[model samples]
Target: MSLLRQLWIMVITITLLAFAGSFAVSMLTARNYLEQQLYVQSADNAAALALSMSQQSKDDATAQLMVTALFDSGHFELVRYTDVAGRVVVERANHAMPEGVPVWFMRLFPIHVGAGQAEVSDGWHQAGRVTVLAHSRYAYLSLWAGAFRLLIWILAAGLLAGIVMQLLFRWVRRPIVQMVDQAEAISERRFITITEPRVIELRQVVRAMNTMVARVKTMFAEQAARIEALRSEANRDPLTQLANRNFFMGRLAQALENEEFAPSGCLLLLRIRDLAGINRRLGRERADQFLQFVAGKLASLSADRHDWLLARLNGADFGLLAPGLSADEAPAFARELLENLAELRRIEITDESDLGTFGIAAYRHGDALSTVLTRADQALAQAEETSNAVVLLSDSDTQATLVAHDWHTLLTGALTGEDFLVASFPVLDRNDRLLHRELMLRLCQPDGRLLTAGAFMPHASRLGLMPVLDLETVRLGLVELGRVSYPLAINLSSTSIADSGFVDRLVSLLRQHRDQAGRLWFEVNEFGFRDELRALAAFGERVRPYGCKIGIEHFGRHFGSIPQLYDLQLDYLKIDGSFIQGIDEHPGNQQLIKAIVGIAEGNDMLTIAEGVHDDGEWLVLAELGVQGWTGPAATGRLQG
Candidate 1:
């Protein structure tokens, strides 16, 4: 039962117990008092009767009648007159007894008491002694009636107390219910703050809930800020204040996919008329400023309906992807942007106002970035020769360009068909022994061409297909493992690492091949680990059994994260190639390598240097406390 129900039940139980106890005490007291009063009344009546009989004549029937009448009307049990020698007696009796109370109540607490007695005699000389027995019928009646009345009073009092208690409980529980409703709302992800309650205890609960809500709001705000930072870093160009190449390419691809009018729209490439000369005359910083000014003007001229996107492709090169715009409309937008740039340049460069020269080239759908850029370069050259502020290619390039292939189709085909393959890379030990061979997955076409991760991973990720590929790769690795006894390592995708089912499968695989588990290694990228370290660590602990080993690949550059290394039971750390490429000369690189070694050593983990192609870097690393090394220097197989 709930707490409130239990408490109310306890209250009722205690109240009933108290009522029973009071009833018992009252019955005992009332019975005893009645017995005492009856005894005194009998004694007084007997004495008075004896004195009156002595004063009258011996055969006085009047006195006898008076006493008999009183005894009969007073509900007496028995009245009697005895002679001096006690040989004969005069007796008076009442009718048979009547039950006044329930038999169960009477049996449960029987009211048994001795009857009151009295002696009747003539005064001064013993005439006849009158002995009387007080009746129990009147006492039983009185006791029964009193008990019934007390029960009714007790019932009324108990009812009133329960009603008052319920009212008080309702008042007290109001704020508690409000707090509960607020908590329920929060559980449903609908945040609500409750007003402070009058009850001190309930007010504390509300305070805690309010604090929790505040914390959640702060956490949400921080998460939003983090997402915004990531977005800005992904899209914004720090230097030109325009979108970067990645953002522009993403939008361009999206535009191509929108088949209605976006895929058939114009793409434009804009360039400074004479960027090198401008840099030579005004210095590099000032030239960059000029480029920013041109970008600003282009941004202002583009209409929102056209969905124009501007990006800095490189130094002095800008791209405009305008979805739903024709090649003719592109030149108009370019002309307006150039005019704004010209006006701004005239105001800034008062001495050589003609330096505001620029070029624009536009192409309708199917024109590659390279082709458009070439046309824009040609236009810029022509503008330089003619000494004009702006120029566009008048002739449309009617020749067919290479069609941008749908990468999603290729990914889907590769994932569904038998196009994906796994390749092995050796991760050697310190003595150039094959400690483990890492399996790297590659996608190959039916045309005998191999595709690297760069060719399909981004598309696979965009299509939410990494987990499938990772699972397939793992199955293939297990298949290949059945063929060999060498130590094998399989790389896990970020999505796979976060999946609980994948973790379970990995553990199950190891458990199935318990003897081979010591030879099996699981690898994850440093980037993936950083994203979900806690989850990965928990996964690591879950799979630590069955003798499997876990290691991180591309593990360097995030030196501040070394503290977490102590918590994770990683078997090895693969230092990134950047630090190992030229470790002897760079002092910073040397210190970093040593620090990583120290961190791993302190945590009882082995450190491996990747890309150690030469003996010198290898020797340096060995001296710096690296226990394992894997690079081109190590042979594919362990030499016995």
Candidate 2:
């Protein structure tokens, strides 16, 4: 139990104990005092009445009259006068019973006080003995009233003290709660510190935590830097800093294979001719510098395109692939790139013929990488015969590419209308137990073809409609969750996570469905998380009370150092496909997956893999302790 709760319980217990003890003692004492007063009054009254009877005639009439008068005064329960012969001359009795006190209470603490008695006498001689008893109804009534009043006071005081202690304990433990939060953050991988509190003991603890956090951050930073360096070295070319041949080929293979990018795209090659001639004239050092310059220019070209990849394919060849680009556009793209390079090297290269030529080919569905490369190479061989010739192979023809205005109009229409919705992909555990439905937003095109968020969200993001897309996604997920009993995972963009208004509205929506909040999970993409960590963490904190689980997808891709996934109390980690691909054949990736699994284990998080293909990779991942799996394999399992 929490210390605050324990303390409150202790306070209440002590209060009740003290109240019970004081109440019992007061009740017993009051009963004794009242009994004594009643007895004294009864004894004294009997003596006075006997004396009055002795002073007067001791006849039966007078005795009966006096007894009647005393009984009528209502203090005595029984009074009697007897003659010397033991014959009763006068008598009085009362049968009134006290009310307003429960029988159980009276039975629990019974008070019995006998009536008082005294001898009666005339001036020097005894007239007749007089006897009297005091009425106990009034005394019982008085005691019951006093006890009720005492109970009320005690209860009121107990309640007031309880309220005060609740507030007091919460205030006293406020700094401790913050320290606990900081510790939890550390456990989650976020090293953090807090201000020292006023209490001397708590201040010492907080200061110690702050020092520990500083050391942990330093330690993790050094370790993360080493891992990041190794990862970068494994994928990047040393000289140009572009993706190495293996990495480039892997991406190229996926581009040709992935369902999202296979439909329409272009692969272009820029070949530098007479490399030996230029290297001999410029020397190896200048030639290397020239190659680096060219690599930089090619890298700069990718900045404008939404989905693009550039790589150093080989010593003399460089490759650029533009996904979602149609056929005819490849020519202008090829021309613009060559023109930029020529303008850049215009002063350096005196002869325009010294510049390289371009060979481009547009790819459609079911096109093989080898076939496309052959087509581009044939075009390059033809271009090599001419000066600064840019060749578009026979395969490269026109199919229309939608302009930006068209996308804006289509996406805007879908949002304002009822066409915007989401489709869920299943996430299953190792035992094929369904975990959740991963909701991906979809836009129903006018042609009745459903377009995935991957198809339109890029343009939406650039146009600052990410927040709108996120809001619609959340709405769709909530409505979907209500229809199903299983949990659902919703993706929130960085823009929506950072937008205060969006967060406020989203939180309110979650609250309105508070009962089902636990069944709804939220996740942001890896890049989105990197875009705004603090905002995401704060947003998670706000919704945490509603029982929503938060985590990142495409995890461990750019993990140079663990981004405070621990701090977020992340529910699960989905390993990116880059590491998951061909894992059975890649020992290095297996080790990387093991390392990621270790991190998740330490943080008490669930680990899953994305884009899983082979059964061997799945088995390897399962042996690596991945609790859940997603992607095509898991999807197929769900469907089966």
Candidate 3:
């Protein structure tokens, strides 16, 4: 039972005991007073009657008349007059029950008194003795009336006390409830504090809880800072603060090999002209500052493009990888870079007008990394001959570029038709058991070609059609879930989650399929999630009731904001593929992964590694406490 209920029962019991005691005392006191008054009246009346009889004649007629008159005029149970020798002269008596009083009450508290007696005289001699007794019906009535009044007063007071107790209980309950909530939040890995109550005991409890939460927050903040530092040390270029050559190559390889990555994109290579000559003309410090300035400008230009990868490839060469950029748009992008680099010359950082040369190479999926590098290098050699110092090398068989209107038409037509399809990749546990299949949306053309989400999603987003596509994907996932017994995960775009209407529709769909909702998972990319945390949180809240799971894919890219995840209550994290690539041979990345696993475990979230390509990587990830794995290796194991 709750403490409040126990207290209420105790209060009621004490009130009843108090009422009983008071009633007993009041009834006893009243009965005693009434009994005393009755005795007094009997004695006084008997004395007065005796005197009256003494003053009158002592004859039988006179005595009988006086006795009868006295008995009739006053309340008496019995009245008698006898001669001095003890012979009866005259007698009168009456016996009757009291009215308006309960028999039970009379039996419980019956009034008792002695009858009064006196001597009578006739001509200076005793004629007969007169006796008078007073009835106790009036006394009983007074006692009963006083007892009833006491009971009514007791009842009124009890009611008032009960009301006051209820209000007091409610006031006490509020602070206790707040304390309970704070404790639960802490258990869920969300450190929250409550206001200290005015009550001393409750205030102490709340203060202790707040202090613990503050300490925990500080601990987590320090841990996240350490992990971020590890990430920088492992992947960042020391001088330029851009991704180092190894990290950049690993990310480029993932984009090229991952099926969900963009089908085609552009790679740009920028080389400083005569770096040794500039270093000798200016001091080493001045040349280092110049390099930093160039790196800063490149980072600023790609600040808004989360998909773009900027890296310091070497001391004099920098690389930019732009996914989803077409060959037709490569020249314009290269000219933009050239224009930005011109700022260095105008600021006199270098005397040579031709500060740098640009080489742009367009690449498609399945192309060799070495082949792309060679093409960019050839483009750089050609740019050194050109006056503008910028050249773009394209593949001869590149596909035709689609305009905005054409893309809208294609996507709308495809969505309306039955050409949209979904492809599943298995995510597995360390025991080789299937966790869930991550579903990717695809578009089937009339020519029997499959177009991945990367090929069309950008256009759909631009046309505000992500809500429609995302809802359809959820519907398809539900249908598949009903056909199969296993759970399924689907990706949602940042744009779709930001749209309130889309959230409503998605939640409605999940509600309609409540049984399948538990088996359905929704994930958003970490890049998008960091910017739309509030929107994603609201979306999670709406769908959580249906048992739908929400998570962030491509996790660990923003290690600095891991602490912000306490309030999200996410179900899982899909570590980015770049960090997972060749993790078995990299100790620094292993520590980073271990830290990530610890953080996720602390929050009760599952950590899944993405893009596992070999048994070595899979084994290392499993040893590092990854709960799930999804990639080429995981898919191969599922097939085997």
lDDT of each: 0.66, 0.77, 0.85
lDDT of 2 by residue, 1-640 (tens): 9776787787778877877898789888988887888888888888888778877877789889988998899888889888766788888988677788777767766666566565556567666678888887888788788888887887788778878888877776889889989877776667778889888889999999999888866665655555456556665677888766555555565566554343567778888777677788878887777778788888788766624767787887888877776666777877777777776466574233457888877776557868987987888888888776788775545335567898889889988887997887888898999999888778898889877665677778768888888888888888887889999988888888999999998888888988778888888878778768889889988888999988788775443345755556677877767667777877666766776776677667888887776678799989878888877788877788
Per-residue lDDT over 546-614 for candidate 3, one digit per residue giving the tens place of the 0 to 100 score: 988889998866434564777788999999888998889888889988988988898899999998999
Off by over 4 Å in 1: 47-60, 87-89, 95-100, 112-123, 131-134, 149-224, 258-261, 269-307, 315-317, 335-367, 372-640
lDDT of 3 at 4: 70
Ranking by TM-score: 3, 2, 1
lDDT of 1 by residue, 453-499 (tens): 53455456667777777777777777777888887887777678898
Pick the TM-score winner: 3
Decreasing lDDT order of the candidates: 3, 2, 1
TM-score against native, each model: 0.51, 0.66, 0.92
The residue pairs found clashing in candidate 1 are 77-135, 120-129, 120-130
